[model samples]
Target: MELMNGVFRPYADSFVIFFIDDILVYSRTEGDHVRHLRIVLQRFREEKLYIKFSKCEFWLNSVAFLGHVVSNEGIRVDPAKIVAVRGWMRPISPTKILSSMGLVGYYRRFVQSLSTIAAPLTRLTRQGVDFRESDGMIAFIEARLSLVKQIRSEAGFVCPRRAS
Candidate 1:
């Protein structure tokens, strides 16, 4: 892709860019790592490229690049996504409520007792009720968000034995 080539061609031998902007600089030795970083930084300056320092990580053996968290530990969902899940809010429309529930349900495996956890909210959906930020709704939202924060993994599928 032009975007990738434009941003990363200069660092090809020593590093690989993941997800377009997530750069993973690799080196065979510590000295090489330092040199590679310097070279890359220099190229960035030359290209007039700017990076968010807060999002930049260095000297990491493993890291979360893109959606999957990469590290020596292996790949998993990014913690920030987990945080986003944990802070999910109840949608205000029937369609949006269903959509939100569906999205979260897709990752149900990451949330323990998902069925039970979502029982209250699900009931409202079944009854064709519009979403509201009522106390119970708020509680359900908080619970789902907390569950998502606690677990960061792809959800398993739960097939409906009988179609509606």
Candidate 2:
């Protein structure tokens, strides 16, 4: 990957970027797009690397990569992943709680206060810490549920409103 990065270093952010096996090319004009693809293909030829053509896409207005729907507008949650999030049950054990956090942690940037909010549950993971939800942990769960509900509504998740 470092070698690939070295090859693409000049075009980073402006035209193309690579991640392990994926490459995304962005251009503002058809002419520029053609030029960018040429440059990338040339680099690939030199590096003796090849892409599986069957998985490639071109002339795309938007693309989904690694759980995000990327487009000119902005990134948004993948509806499929949202479905999984919505289906998640309240975690009962320390292991389950950690697992849930691991799943959700990918979106940590969207949840600015996550560390503070998850402090209680995180403490339960520490050595000699009782594997029980303390008062703070309960509050964290409540806050998490509220946040998930808001995200669901934003993503057009339709359901009967609960009585608060």
Candidate 3:
């Protein structure tokens, strides 16, 4: 990825982003997009790097990158991520709490006051803190549910209630 970054250093964050081998070239207008694409393709050629034609996507209004969907409407957590969070088990220990936090942290930008909402779990992760099953478990469930609700609302997905 360093090599890729070096190749596109001039364009980084102006109209391009590099994540490992994936390069996203973005522009506001069709003409600008074509010009940006040409520059990126030229850099790839200069660096002797090849992109798989099958993986290349161009002129998309929105695209999924690094688990979030980017569009004119703005970035949002992917629905698949919401589903995964929905299925997350209640944290029983500090380790579990940390792991859950790691996953939720990835989408922290989409949810408001995420750090405040996750304070209960965060407290349990501190040294010398004992994990209280009942209080912490309730907080975990509430936090997870809050995240799902917020993400769903932002993504404009109406989830049907599951039958008991």
Candidate 4:
């Protein structure tokens, strides 16, 4: 959090976006990109932060961030993630259902009314509720499947522009 506020805050909604340990630096042109990259690297150097080069993405038009593909155009669920979601089988237990729900829940930004659709499954996971694969199970399947399609076709990660 200190790194986020102290090092990246100035560049936060503009040239760089850092979520946890993943840092994505973007610019409209190669020259601007180089400058932005230099600035970030210099800061890290100043702070004595170590970076394993193997894990870094230097120059790319788009890259996967937290299971979502992000670019200047917008953000969308990574195709790889969507494939995993599509292959999910009907969960037979509360734990299974919760796991499935948790995965899809991460990409809820891609789907409208996802919380409402997921309410059924959420209920089944609550304490004292018998984990029954009845109404909630149906809703879960439908919600899971629908999220795959929506993310694949229509979803875009919209970065909010903070008022400067």
Candidate 5:
């Protein structure tokens, strides 16, 4: 926590630090944000805590922090998490397939018709077939990749309607 405090002290006026690891720098004005960032970076240097510059995002209307993606709009699944879903691959061994299935199944709710889409692959597992990419696998891969962009957007979850 000491490290976080040192990294955050300079930007105290403009931003609120959350959960030590997650930093939410707020700005009442665009100019404030710029200034706040500079101060924050300096504090980081003083603290000797280096941020992964490549992963550091700035001036984003929304950003994925921790497991949840945050934006000016709202919170949702992290884009990095979605990329994992999109890049999912069929497993070669029975154990491997089951493990992969478990991981993918966790996010099944986010993917539409997940069972229907994965039916063929699931059947292969039940029948104890060796891992081999088939037409069904190829189709599934293509279908899931196609849905990546849409799923990351508004289609993620069903929002409740306002009561009249």
Candidate 6:
């Protein structure tokens, strides 16, 4: 991954984002996109790395990278990834609680003060903490409900921009 970074260091963030073997080149215009794609491909050629044509997609208005979708509207958690939360059963153990937290934590940036919102659930995970039905169930339900509300709003990690 570090090697990938060095290979595209000059263009990182401006037009390209590379993770391991995946390279996503983005641009606001068709002409600029072509230029950006050329630069990225040229780098691959120079470095003797090969990209499989079958796995490549071009000229898309939106693309899924990692777990989120990047598009003109800004990044959002992929709906498919969150569908499981809709039917999630109440967690019964510390491990289950942690798993629930992990799911929400993945999109923590979209939910403000998630740590505070999930405090009770977090406490249930700590050693020597008694996992009472009242306390744990209330916290778990609250956290899950909060996440569902946020999902309904279609919120996720949207980068802030300064006023022009």
Predicted model with the maximum lDDT: 6
**Clashes, model 4:** 1
lDDT for each candidate structure: 0.63, 0.69, 0.80, 0.79, 0.63, 0.82
Report model 3's TM-score to 2 decimal places: 0.86
lDDT of 4 by residue, 55-110 (tens): 98788878888787877676778889889989988776779878987887888777
Across 39-82, the per-residue lDDT of candidate 2 in tens digits comes to: 99999899888878899998897788677666655556566766
Q: Which lDDT value does model 2 have at 11?
A: 95
Please identify which of the two predictions, 2 or 3, would achieve the higher TM-score against the true structure: 3
Decoy 2 TM-score against native: 0.72
User: Quick one: ranking by lDDT, best first?
Assistant: 6, 3, 4, 2, 1, 5
Best-performing candidate as measured by TM-score: 6
Kindly list the per-residue Cα lDDT of model 5 for residues 1-164, writing each as its tens digit. 66676557655634655566767775656997888788777776876878787866788876656555555544566677777766776556656556655655665556677677667656656664544657656755765664576467645543222222
RMSD of each: 9.6, 7.9, 7.4, 3.1, 7.2, 2.2
> Which ranges of candidate 4 are over 4 A from the true structure?
126-136, 156-164
Model 5: CA > 4 A from native: 1-66, 146-149, 154-164
TM-scores for candidates 1 onward, in order = 0.45, 0.72, 0.86, 0.79, 0.47, 0.88
TM-score, ranked from best to worst: 6, 3, 4, 2, 5, 1
Cα lDDT tens digits, model 1, 113-152, are 8777767666666555545647557757766765674464
Report lDDT (Cα) of residue 77, candidate 4: 80
Error of 4 at 127 (Å): 5.2
**Candidate 3 lDDT by residue in tens digits, 12-108:** 9888988988888877678988999999999889889898999998889888888877765556677789899999976666898888889888777
lDDT of 6 by residue, 46-115 (tens): 9998989999999888899987788866788777767777767887688988897888898888777788
- What is the alpha-carbon RMSD of candidate 3 to the true structure? 7.4
How well does candidate 1 score on lDDT at residue 100? 64
Q: Ten residues in a row with the worst lDDT in model 6?
A: 155-164
TM-score, structure 6 vs. true: 0.88
